[model samples]
Target: MNAAPSVRAVIARHCRELLADPLLHGDPTLRDIAAQCHQPLRVLLVGNVSTGKSTLLNALIAGPLAATAFEETTSSVTWYHGPEPADPVLPDPGHRSVTTDFPLAGRVMLGDSPGLNTLSDNPRETLRMLGGSDLTGAAAAFVCVLVGGRVDQWAEGLEELAAFSAGPFDLVGNIVAVMAKVDEVDEAVEDIERRVSGDTTATFRFAAVNQLMAAAARTGAVDDRIVATLDRLRTLPVMHGRSAPAWDRLAEEVGTALPPGHLKALEQVVGAPAWLPALVAATAGMTTTGAVAEQFERMSRIRSLEAVLSDLADDSDLFTSTAAVLRLRRLAARLKPRPAALVRARLADLTATMHTSGLHRRAAARLVRHTDVGSGLTEHERAAAQALLRWPDAGADGGGTSDRATAAEVDVGAVLARWTAYEADPFRDSRSREVAALVIETARHRLRTTTRQEES
Candidate 1:
């Protein structure tokens, strides 16, 4: 039986054809880019060491394929895909890739990337997986899984999010943030949630997830209340004429039955009280059907993340395919004994068409940071652009905020004026004139874009 080659494979094949062509035998860069393009869309689980990144993947796949410990568990880049092979496949002596029929394996490959700032070779590996170098370009989106209530840790992940940007492809547009260990910061939940939701950084869809609670409720301890809550929700009409009691209150009843330490533990890793009922409902049976697995997935928010990934897959398909075509056609045009003039003209037209397509400009604009002007923009200016660009979609896609949910808005002109009058004067770093000009222009563009979006 013949099977279709994957998008990456097609790119690789094209590269081979081009390489073997008598007319284009000299250039190797084109071959290298084709090989890099062969990489599948790798969804990275990025964060600091030991933030339950691997454990969360295990819960997501409903298997313990990723080694998990209280400390840094992932040692290298591991890729997971569907349809288990007879044995493991290692692409390189240093890295491993495996096939498993996990719920998400079929749609896209999942990569468990070590913490980007780890002490070992992990950071280098993380960058390579994300295509974060000159030789490689990104064919991936990020799921920034962070431990609860730590702005510092979250900042580290955001650094990776921004770092993924290169040239005209803005991989940051594909990021989906996950607040891990939601249960650990009970006392300051409101404040921390405020901090995260309020962050002025890039606005991307986010989920406050407690993979531990989701896993525990489904596979480990069964709190009677969790079961009870699930049963109640199942019985009621999803949109009853009247309101239903809060699910957390129902879970609290189950919490009461457990020992104080156990209850505390439950509270430590439990996610939004809203998902409690669904978590228990997920594993209420000896075996799970597709429906049950789906329910569990939603409660775990893994399904939510998967849905996001699926949409991103479509986006990735468009972006990467167009990028591949443009890259190759451009190379072919530049090759010695280049194609017929008509063929070259068509290639240029096709490349231009790809550049102007949907979301392409906005995505490219995101790469401004790689430019001298963008890098010179003050941190405040850059953040302002992020908030403005994201406000329209972020409100819709990013999960609802709690008491601290309101976006901590920024005011740039006011900030800039202060900089102008600062005690020592700002921008005395020798690029003062250049920095100010870029900052003003960037802020103006951001302001106009935001205003136009709001009006629409």
Candidate 2:
């Protein structure tokens, strides 16, 4: 579906901001990058080793772009799309491959990545990359493919996938559990499917055991054992939602709860909260329909902004560049008037849209609307708007001094001096610290510029 006008406006605004960003100016392909941002669907295939992940990748692409083998073959995260065949293997610090191709369902771009359970020592890192990839901002759905096996194995895989899928970086209402290889199970798959579906509260899509068996028959790679496992998987209901709580409950019931070492391992690899075990249980017990719906909305907005920014940054022209800046400035102004409330309202509106149009379009629309500079005040409105922006937290009763006092006072000169000291050793400490210093300096510079402009 095409994005609404407001959505388009928000995206345009973000494009403007990204173009204005000093860091993104070097690249010449910004315009192409921006266009890619507008596509509707970007589905990703992610799962454990030998779980028909490659086969699924093949099925999605309908081609042999992803290498499939008996043994774990993926050495790094490989991205697959469509049409173009350019292999620019740039070094990505985050261990991700950026590709532009894949079928377009409206504006969506489908993505295929390396299997999560590969033999590499960096399997954890691979999963991290999958979870952290910019695809999170670009994706409309995540199809998690898995084979049916012993309950224990299935449980373990689900737990691992869940841990990787949590937090701010998660897909928005975009997760689907695909049970492949269902033809081998002796019993009816419906019973198992129903039971598991009840346990997870997330939507489960089932593929009959025969579907994979037929594909295997054609390929001759289908082992009887693997087929049987696939049958079991078919009979198994697709488990959805957070697996941590279910795993934790099972552990507590068996009195074999995760040990401290295992817990620490999960924390380090997954970066979940220390109380994640409890949180998972709580999330599982609570109805997640509302939460999932909300997440979809938030994701849509984020993606929309990403697309807009990509476009604005890539296509540099005088009007486009100026438009981008004005858009963000207007956004900042809107945010300043009742910053918290505006943010909340925008978030809510975006979330509401997710249930109908998937995530990306809604997100695109949100980005356009939120970022549109023209939506803010005209010149006549600037004085009042600027006053509100300057002291957003001011109380109705006494003025905004109390609120301003509560805000953290930034010392830009001190921050800049510290940054200069660290210039010789940039790798020391966290990059976030460095970025914070830069932001402080920028804010100070902007403030001074504004003061001077006002005086003149």
Candidate 3:
């Protein structure tokens, strides 16, 4: 028996066959798509200016690929594929920059466009690039890095994805939302995920990552333990008065393992030792003298983004199928008497694979819109379902919905009463009753946790 063909092989075969078709060959766009399919999968990094789009790209592909940045040319779109480029050309070099050299270049072609909010019509270009499935290849997906703060504050930026995604007969997904520089924020990673989870129209997969630590991890200069140690030190209480001398000395002693450069950077970044987390935040800007690539790679949270990228790469066949369908549609679009039957037949073959594609699944993302109450389902229920799906024995491990909305924000007492009613409902079927019982238990646990917080 033969092993199933790899996604790359299938995509290559599909592109070759499509290119040979006399019908599509005449169209430059489809031909370009055919040519691009032969290249590695592309993941576009799109976000507003100074949201660290270029920095994140450098972290991901190890080239200041976004350096040929900003609105030097209205139609400029920098492609970072090939053997990996030389050190990044920074300060927007006033021209396009492209190179190959860093690792994973062949496996993935990364595109870093100018910021969405740049003076150059880059956002328009970005939308065009996103809409042009042929140019980016079917396997191309996007990472929409949102600025941290109120979702309402970044609503316009988040909504930009919808506009980019908007096109007749064009269904785009496989887009992930990543919160960048999350360490600078006051919220926990999980809370940010929760708040942003309300923005259903924007991103499907949401992750709050500390790219600084991720860069550290990738650089081999720092390990998870070191990051953890830095975090611990940042929180350590500093001594001041004469009575606090011993504690102050101990705090200094604990922080000694930190690199001198990192310490200095932290001092500069934080200004004064106001608190522990502040020190931790300062560690984010520390850079290695000779290890730009590794340094950026570790802490940039590029690894988290890469996991999604790799997933998209692994599903290259779906991308290929998606691209082929789009091409067919485009060809059909150009026809006076649209070849609906012909296009449908060609597209029909892809429906099964399309359903399984990450793009389609992403399109079907379960959005938890904010109402006047809790998100209906507690975090625990979500975890239990996940556990049951993945591995039953694993169960829930401190992963559940945090019912943080106060009674003032929404009627807390009424919410609990409903769950209680469901739990005690005699008319509920046995199966439903079992589920309700579980819900009741979860609510009770949540209330207890909330009570502890209030008491503390």
- What is the C-alpha local distance difference test score of each model? 0.51, 0.36, 0.48
TM-score of each: 0.53, 0.39, 0.54
From the highest lDDT down, the ranking of the candidates is: 1, 3, 2
How many steric overlaps does candidate 3 have?
25
Q: Pick by TM-score: which candidate is best?
A: 3
Best by lDDT: 1
**Cα-lDDT of candidate 3:** 0.48
Compose the digit string of candidate 2's lDDT tens values, residues 1-456. Answer: 122233323443344344455544422222222333343334456667766666555544334456666577655655554434343322143334445443332232344555675456746544543444322223334566666622334545454444444222121233445654433333345564565555552322223222222222223332333222222222223322233233344334324232333433222211222223322333342233344223322321223323322322221121122222222333334433544244344434433652212222222222222222113223322222222222212221122223222212434344345434543354544432333333334445546755897999
**Candidate 2: deviation at residue 171, Å?**
8.1
Model 2, position 16, has a per-residue lDDT of 38
Position 187, candidate 2: lDDT: 37
Look at candidate 2 and tell me the lDDT of residue 32.
24
Query: What are the per-residue Cα lDDT tens digits for candidate 3 across 274-328?
Result: 3334334546544443343344344444666676665455444444445545555
CA shift at 368, candidate 2, in angstroms? 26
Error of 3 at 51 (Å): 1.2
lDDT by residue (226-252, candidate 1, tens digit) is 344344444444313233235455345
